[model samples]
Target: MKTIDLRSDTVTLPAQSMMDAIASAQLGDDVFQEDPTTNELESLAADTMGKEAALLVPSGTMANLVAVLSHCERGSEVILGDQAHTFMYEAGGISAFGGIHSRQLPNQRDGTLKLEDVESAIRQDNVHFPPTRLICLENTHNRCFGMPLTVGYTKSVAQLAGDNGIAVHVDGARIFNAAAALKINVKELTGSVDSVSFCLSKGLSAPVGSLVCGSAEFIAQARRNRKALGGGMRQAGIIAAAGIEALKTMVDRISDDHRNAKILADGIAEIDGLSIDIDTVKTNIVYFSLKRLEIAGEVLVNRMSELGIHFFELSPHTYRLVTHADVDENDMDEALKVFKKVMADL
Candidate 1:
């Protein structure tokens, strides 16, 4: 049986066209800024995000870390959601490597931090508190049911940070999904922020790479930080070529993944022992709980694995499923059938 992998969009492989582009990629050392394909990808990424420039990094973690270090001084502070990927998932690189402090505020279910909460978190100029240097926001927040932060909310946070002389950096790993879901241009969400980093490896379907976009000066600093972290790649246009293809052709089709996720969420909700809020199935990520079922999440995972279905266990009872380029509506239907059979057996 063919496995229907719903664990993450990162599992997606590049299309054949991307492989062709990679095979024909123009090569030069990216560390020396001489690769034409890498330059094109960076330029395209900057144009997409409406930034002055962009730097391609090895992964989203390095992209965010570079942006953080570029914007903040050592021992400074960053304000972000408690559940944000930067704070919860990035292995504390900013604090570990940059000596920067992170102050996390609650992330509302809709994946927004309250404006009042952000205002209160900004530190005063007194020596008693670590100086607040930057504010970070995650688009299509990974852990918050993949909820997309609205342009209005992002602008508000940017305005708040601007007035306080603090920079705003968006961890936009799934930003294209956010743009597709909101039916708005990606620039509308990224316009006011100081920097935004988006992943090509996720739903964009590139094999490996993420771009950090910002003003030219900001990106210059980010490039240095990326090198310091050992993220520099020589002749990296092989992957950058695939990224160029992903950005050009794969953006609009993300809506199909969103549709499949909704279908999956609705189907799972109908099962007697499974539960999910179909409304939260806004983008490609679906989160459901095995609340009514008596079986443990681990047991369900093993059983599902035996049936050629796989997803991430978010907790002892909650699980996450993501639709991507490789999985289609038919695959979703098959996965749902497997889920129903598994629940019935339990």
Candidate 2:
């Protein structure tokens, strides 16, 4: 049987073309700001996103941390959704490394932090409270089944952040997915935020890295923060070359992954025991659960693995299925068959 890997888009390997770009990439020490390809990628990413400057970092986590450090001072607070990647999945890096505090509010099913709640959470210059310096958002929010937060929603948050003299940072690791889902240019959705970071590795299929873009001054500070975290790389252009190629040729293709995801979600929903919100499969990630099953999630996961169909856990009962460049029509069909077989055995 053919293997279907639906764990995440981060599982995607570089395409042959991207590998070629990597092999031919020019090299230099990026810490010296002389690596031509890294410089070019950062410049192009900044221009593409309508930001004053951009910095390349080793991973999305580094990009988010650098942005967090640039936006907040020690003991300052940053507000974000309780389910957000920055708050939940990032291992509390902001608080640990930057001495910033996280004030988390529950996210709506659609992956938005309630505007009114967020507004309420802003710290007054009380002699008693930690001052809130930042508000963060995620696009194509990972935990909410990859739902795309709308521009109007984002602009409202940005405006609210502005009202409170807080800078807004967008953890846009999959912002292109949101843009494609909303039928808007990625820049239009991101233009209002104070700083934004978008991944080059996920879905875009670059070998490594992400770009953090914002004001020139913010990026300068972010560069220093990156170095402080030991994120500064010498001669990083070899990997950066693939990032440039990924941006140039791969972003627009996420629509196909979205389409395939919809196909999988809709198909899985038709099964008797599978429970899924088809509408929530908005981007590349589809999350669903099995209803009243005798089988445990791990057991089913193992069963699916034996069938060469694969995914991962989000919770005790919930499973996450992601569609990416490697998963095409044939893979989706195989996955559906595996699902049916597993249900039958149960």
For each candidate, the alpha-carbon lDDT, in order, equals 0.94, 0.91
- Among these predicted structures, which one has the highest lDDT? 1
Encode model 2's per-residue lDDT on 1-346: one tens digit a residue. 6778898899889999998998998999999999999999999999989899999999999999999999999999999999999888888899899999899999999999998899899999997898999999999899988999899999999999998899999999999999999999998988999999999989898878999999999999999999999999999998899999999999889999999998899899889888998878889999999786666778878888988988997898799998888789878877898899888877
- The digit string of per-residue lDDT tens for model 1 on 11-97 reads 999999999999999999999999999999999999999999999999999999999999999989999999999998889999999
Q: CA lDDT of 62 in candidate 1? A: 95
RMSD of 2: 0.9
Error of 1 at 87 (Å): 1.0
lDDT of 1 at 338: 95
Off by over 4 Å in 2: none
Q: Give candidate 1's whole-model lDDT.
A: 0.94
